[model samples]
Target: MRIKTTRQQHILRIKTTLRWLLYYLLIFLSFIIMTSGTLYKPILLVPLAIAISINNNIYGSAVTGAFCGFLIDICCGKLFGYNAVILAFFCILTNLVFELYLKNRFINYLMITAVVSYIQCWLDYKFYYQIWDYENVGRIFVRVSLRVWAYTVISAFFMYLLVKLVNKLLMPKEHLTIEEAINTNIQNENKR
Candidate 1:
């Protein structure tokens, strides 16, 4: 009985690890696809990271957000850790908001995504273009920043669905039999 319990625990750990790895892989794949030299890159990482934050704990969401932001920095050729910090902060805040105030619904997530994406875009425009006093800053903001924000918000719908599907597929099913439940209870009592 002890050996069987240990084996089951090991298997559960492996499954949990695999699920996290799949999430990271999804982020990497999105990074590659979004940065592949299209006329209008959609800033796909923003929505995807937000979607991830919606489903994960605060620490996990922050780490995922930092990873996504690191990719964004690389894609944009900006200073390292800039987007990472911003994204991590936003991810934590989003997680807290969901935990406290908002329900985890599609429209709610989309609205949050829009706000976060717009803030990112506006900050990028302000620091990189406006502060630098670049010629035609308004034009650049309208053409690039606004478009990127719109595209990112549009992509949020798909990212949210993808995240929901992944979560459903990987989440552990809790259908223990009576005997299994008894064994689990015994194990817990033994630990105490």
Candidate 2:
């Protein structure tokens, strides 16, 4: 049994802290981008929901979703707390599914994103148009169809790529196996 040196443990802690900071910073920046209206109605929320699902941290993802949803509500000028509630629910749900069955694959993300996108669009349409009676089904369908692909789908792909890249950058390298560690120590001793 080998114990890690104090310096080594300290370094590891620092690395972990730094990684978390980077991850949160990235999320914050993305939240700002989504709310700033700079992208001409980007579909950032759905992808963000999917990203939280794949994030593997229920509490953290839920919090992030809530924050982003709040920002979204502010930007859209809709009733406060509506998007926040929906996004938080989806975040928790997605995290559970990913933890139990899914492996965070791209295809899985795409399918999940598509479903979420549909739900989001429907909700937005319903709430914005106040279509409780559902009288004009044709117009709703046409509008949904046009807006679904107009920016959300493409923005989702972009957000996916961004998430992947950020994950790759922040993820720590794999730890050495016991055998590798021993070999490394032996090689270092030989050099000394």
Candidate 3:
């Protein structure tokens, strides 16, 4: 069983810290792009939020989602906590789904991001604009949901690729095979 040397451990720690820093930088850029509002609409925040959630632990994901959502809300001038609440809930939902059913696959992440983006669009229309006219309800829902879903799916692919790339670059490759792990465990036991 090969153990990592002290110098290697220190390098690993630095890499981990840099990886997390890159994550925050990506998230901040997403917030800025989404809030710029130069496009017809923006879906970067939702998919990026979901990507972060998928890559982190449940509580960590929740906190990240809430913080990003809060920034979004402040940028959009919505109710103080509205975006934060919805984003945190969506993050928790996706994290639970990942834990229970979905593998950490790109397709699953894309689908979840699309679904969450659609739901967020619906909520935005309802709360921000109060669009309650029954006659145009179906039309509005179909139009907004599809547009948001499309943009979100596109953005999800980019964010997914970014995560994969950064993880590959910054994280250490786990060289310990199952047999190695078992041997190390036995050796530790003998030492104790």
Candidate 4:
């Protein structure tokens, strides 16, 4: 017998304008935290991506990506807007994969994030950066791409832990599951 899955209800909703301000604040804080410290030095982006992807909310995903990328830009003090553009792209890719293929499975999260993060780094090096010469390509690949895979793969578990931690700390008494959000909107509209 298939078990019935019920949607969780949210006390907070994007239903309000103030909620958007909350989103911005959360995004800004998350971005600062993700960018502030030097974790391992090689794999900063993956965990940040995971942090955003876990909630499976578009607002969270976009905000996390946008802020993380901006932080990188600010810290690296290099090409402006590069990280932002790439992260936004990752947001779209993650959303597409979630909607079409994965449906919020753990493996899907790992695979999507790993794939997107790797591609972003590779492109960042290849097109946006010519700092490295032809001979350095192999070295860069080993350092950046390979490291990213390792980072994402290893970071996946920690990401899970982080989600659980967030759930414990910041979780609401009632929060909207994807279904609840849709149904709530539908019902609210019918009343109007």
Q: Give the alpha carbon lDDT tens digit for every residue of 79-160 in model 2.
A: 8988888888887888889889998788888777777777876777767765666677657656654465357766777777
TM-scores of all candidate predictions against the true structure: 0.84, 0.72, 0.78, 0.61
TM-score of 1: 0.84
Question: Arrange candidates by lDDT, highest first: which order?
Answer: 1, 3, 2, 4
Cα error of candidate 2 at position 31, Å: 3.9
Q: Pick the candidate with the highest lDDT.
A: 1
Instruction: Write candidate 1's Cα lDDT for 93-166 as tens digits.
Output: 99999989999899999999999999999999999999989788899999988998898899988888888888
lDDT of 3 by residue, 118-143 (tens): 78777887764556566666666567
Compared with the true structure, all predictions reach lDDT values of 0.87, 0.71, 0.79, 0.60
- TM-score winner, 2 or 4: 2
Minimum summed lDDT over a 10-residue window in model 3 is located at 127-136
- Residues 101-175, candidate 4, lDDT per residue (tens digit)? 666566777677677667766776777455646765776667655775576567656655655455545554544
Off by over 4 Å in 1: 1-8, 173-192
Model 1: clashing residue pairs?
none
In model 3, state the lDDT of residue 21. 91
Best by TM-score: 1
